[model samples]
Target chain A: MQRAKVVGTLWLSSAIEDIRGFKILILKDLSSSKGGYFLAVDTVQAGVGDEVFTVSGSAARQSEATKNSVSDTAIVAIIDRVNEENI
Target chain B: MQRAKVVGTLWLSSAIEDIRGFKILILKDLSSSKGGYFLAVDTVQAGVGDEVFTVSGSAARQSEATKNSVSDTAIVAIIDRVNEENI
Candidate 1:
C-alpha cells in the first residue's frame, strides 16, 4: 500500500448500478520518486487532507460499493502515521 | 511503488475536457496480503496481462495525456519481474 492524501471528491450522476452506494475520492499517490496522485474508491471514510492507504483492482472489487462496480482503485485504510526506517 | 496487474481497460466517451486523449485501464494491486486491484492510468504501454508500476495524483497529472486532465492514477512503468527478499 502507498501513502496518499485525499485531494478531492468525484460526483457521478450515473455510474454502474451496483456502485450506487459507494463514494469515490481523488487521491495523491505519495510513493513515487516525484510523488503522484489518482482517483480512488474510498472505503475507510477518509476526508480531504487525510492521509490514507489505497488498494486497487480485485481488492477494490471486494468492497460493497464495487460488488458489481467496474472500479480499479479503493481506499482500504486511513493512515494515522507512518514510520520510515533507514534503508 | 506497488506491483499491479492490468486487468482491463476503460473506454470513456465524455470525460473532463483535458483528459480527452488519455487512455484509462483497470489495474489490480498486487501488494495486499489478500491481493487487490483498481483502475489506473497507463503510461507504459502495458497490456492486460502485464505487471506494471503505477503513479497517482499530481504525479499522474504530470503526464502529457493528463496535462489538463482531472485524473488520479497513471501507470509509470512496466515490470519484467520482482524478487522478494526474506524479511
Candidate 2:
C-alpha cells in the first residue's frame, strides 16, 4: 500500500467491458518524497483533493469495489489526516 | 499497460528484500489523461520528465530488471512520443 493525494478524476465514456461503470481518479504518488502520480480506479468516494491509501495487484482486487472485478489498482482507504512529523 | 510521464525518482534506504537495488520513480499517469501519478520501479533507463509505458502486476515482473524479482509495477518502455490528436 502507498499514500497518495487525489489530483483529479477520469471520465471514460466508452471503456473495456471489465472496466465499465467504475470511477477512475488520478492520484499523486506520495510514497516517495519525489512528486509523481498515476491513474487509479477509485473504490472509495474520493474527491479531487482527498488523501488516500492505494493498494495494487491482487491486494487491489480485494477492495470492496474491486472484489471479483478486473482491476489492478484501487483506492483502499480515504486518509483522514496525515502526520509526517518523522519525515 | 498505461502511458505515463516520469516525474521524479525515489531513493529508498531501507526496502523490502524483493525490491532491493531497484531504481524507483514517481510516474504521472497519463493513460486516462487525469494527471495522476504512482510510484513505480523503473526497468528501463527512463529519466525524469520522460514519457513511459508502464506495466503492472505479473507482467511487470517479466521486464529485464524484474525477471525473477518481486515487484508489481515497472516501467516497461520509454515512449518516444505521444500523438493525442484523437483526444
Candidate 3:
C-alpha cells in the first residue's frame, strides 16, 4: 500500500461493465511528485484532501466493494496520522 | 494494469501467511525512469528480462494463482507487443 491524497472525483457516463457501481477518485501519490496522479476506486468513503492508503493491482479488485470489478486501484483505508519514527 | 520488466527474484525465509506459495519477483516500471523497483507476485511464469503487465490492489489477490493471498501486486500477463499508434 502507498499513501496518497484524494484530489478529485471522476465522472464517467459510460464505464466498463465490472466497474459500474464504484466511485472513482483521483489520487496523488504523497511520496512522489513526478508521477502525477492516478484514478482509484473509493471504498473507504474518502473525500478530497483526505489522506488515504491505497492498494493497487489485483489486490484492488478484491475489495468487498469492488469484487468482480475491473478496478486496478482502490482506497483501502483513511489514514488518521503518521509517525515517521515508528515507521 | 501497467507494463514492467521483471528484474530479479526474492528469496524469503519466512513470508506472510497468505503469500506462501507465490513467487515474488522484482519489477521495474517500463513507463517511468525514476520510480525504482517494487515487488510483485508472479502468476504468469515471467522470467527476468521479460516484459509483463501487472495488476495491483485487490484485483491481484483475485487471480486464480493468488486467490486468498495477501499480495498487493501480481503479474497478470506477458506482453507480446505494443502498438502505440493504435492506442
Candidate 4:
C-alpha cells in the first residue's frame, strides 16, 4: 500500500464494463519525490483532498471493494493519521 | 497488470515471514517513459531480462502462486509476444 492524496475525480464516458459504478480518482503519491500521480478506483468513498492508502496491480481486483473489477489501482483505506516515527 | 522487464533480483536477509521462499525481483515498466522500477515477487520463475506481466496490490497476495504471502507485487506471467494492433 502507498500513501496518497485524492486530487480529483475521473469521469469516463465509456470504460470497461467491469468497472461500472466505481468512482475513478486521481491520486498524488505522498512519498515520492517525483510527485507521481495515477488513476485509481475508490472503494472507501474517498473525497478530493482526503489522505488515502491505495493498492495497485492485481491486488486491486481482489479487494472486497473492487472484486471482479478490472481495476489495477484501488483506494483501500482512508488514513486518519500518520506517525512517521512508528513506521 | 503491467508489462515490465525483470532487471534483477532482490536478496532480502530479513523480510516478513509470509513472503519467505518467494524470489523478489526488480522490474522496470516497459510502457512508462520515466523508466520506473519496483520490487515484485516471482511466481512464474521469471529470470533476469525476461519480459513478464506483474500483478500489484492485494491481488498480488491472492494468486495461487503467492496465496497466503504478504507480497504486494507478484510476477504472474511471462510474455512471449505482444500484439499491439490487436489491443
Candidate 5:
C-alpha cells in the first residue's frame, strides 16, 4: 500500500464499459517526493486533501466498491495519521 | 495506451503470489517529457531499446499471455514505426 492525497474529481461523459458508473478521483502521490498525481476509483469516502492509502493492479478490483471492476487503482482506506517513529 | 522504451529487465527473488513466473521489465515512459520509469510485464518478445506501447490497469490482464494474471501494466505490442504525421 502507498499513501496519497485526493486532489480532485473526474467526470467522464463516456468511459470504458468496465469502469462506468464510478466516481473517479485524482490523487497526488504522497509516497514520492515529486508530488505526482494519478487517477483512481474512490472506494472510500475520500475528499480533496484527505490522506488515503491505495491498492494498485488487480488488487484495486478486490475492493467491495470496485469488485469485478476494471480499475487500475483504488483508494481503499483513509489515514488519520502516520507515526514516523515506526520506520 | 502510451509509448515507452524498454530500458532493462528485473529479476525478483521474492514477489507476490499473482506474478510468480513473469519477467518484469523496466521501461522509460516516452509519453511524458519528464520520462518517468516504471515496471511492466513483457507480453511481446521485446528487448532493450525497443519502442513499445503498453496497457495499464486491469486491461493489462486482458492479453492472452497475461489473462487471469494480476499485472498492473503490460507491454502489449512493439512499435515498428511511428507515423508522426498521422497521429
Candidate 6:
C-alpha cells in the first residue's frame, strides 16, 4: 500500500460498463522522491484532501464495490496518524 | 502497458512461495513524468539494458509463467521501434 492525498475527482463522460457506479479520484502520491499523481477508485468514501492508503493490482478488485470492475487501484483505508519509529 | 528500460536484476533469497521460479528485474520507468524505478517479474527473458514494455495489475498474471503467483508487474513485450505517426 502507498500513502496518498486525494486531490480531486474525475468525471468520465463514458466509462467501462462495470465501473459506472463508482467514483474515480485523482490522488497525488506523497512518498515518491519526485512528486507525481495518478487515478484510483474511491472505496472508502474519501474526499478531496483526505490522507489515504491505496491498494494496487488485482487486490483492488477484492472490494465489494469494485469486485466486478476492472479497477486496478482503490483507496482501501484512510490514515489516522503515522507513528515515527526510527529504523 | 508502460515502456521501461531494464537496469538491473534483483536476487531474493526469500520470496513468495509460488513465485520462486521467476527472475525479477529492476526497471526504470521511461514514460513517467518524473523518473522512477520499480521491480517486475521478467517473463520474456529480458536482460539489463533492454528496452521493454510492462503490464501491471491482474494483466501481469496472464502470462503462463506468472499465472500461479501474485505478480503485480511483468515485462510483457520488448520495444522494437518507435513509429513517428502524429497522433
Question: Could you say which candidate leads in DockQ?
Answer: 3
Residue pair clashes in candidate 6:
none
TM-score of chain B of each: 0.84, 0.86, 0.88, 0.89, 0.89, 0.90
| Candidate 3 lDDT by residue in tens digits, A1-87 | 788888766554323345456676666678675755566778988988898999876677676787786578789999999877745
**First chain of model 5: TM-score?**
0.89
Once fitted onto the true fold, the runs of candidate 1 whose alpha carbons sit more than 4 angstroms away are: A1-87
The residue-level lDDT of candidate 6 at A47 comes to 81
- Tens digits of per-residue lDDT, candidate 1, A4-77, equal 78999989886767667678898887654446668887766779998765655444555444547777777755
Cα lDDT of model 6 by residue, A6-85, tens digit: 87665442232444566666677776756566667788889888989998877788878777654667899999998868
- Indicate the TM-score of model 3: 0.53
On lDDT, the stronger of 2 and 3 is: 3
Candidate 2 clashes between residue pairs 3 or more apart in a chain or in different chains = A37-B36, A37-B37, A37-B38, A38-B36, A38-B37, A38-B38
User: Which RMSD does model 4 reach against the true structure?
Assistant: 10.0
Candidate 4's docking class is: incorrect
Which stretches of model 4 miss by more than 4 angstroms? Answer: B1-87
What TM-score goes with each of the models? Answer: 0.48, 0.52, 0.53, 0.53, 0.54, 0.53
What DockQ does model 5 achieve? 0.08
lDDT of 1 at B4: 80
Could you tally the backbone clashes for each prediction?
Answer: 25, 6, 21, 6, 0, 0
Which docking band does candidate 2 fall into? incorrect
Off by over 4 Å in 3: A1-70, A73-87, B85-87
Runs off by more than 4 Å, candidate 5: B1-57, B61-87
Q: Which stretches of candidate 6 lie over 4 Å from their true place?
A: B1-32, B35-56, B59-87
For every candidate, C-alpha RMSD to the true structure in Å: 14.8, 10.4, 9.3, 10.0, 9.5, 9.7
Best of the two (1, 4) by lDDT: 4
lDDT of 3 by residue, B2-62 (tens): 5678999998877878778788999988644465688898877789998766667666666
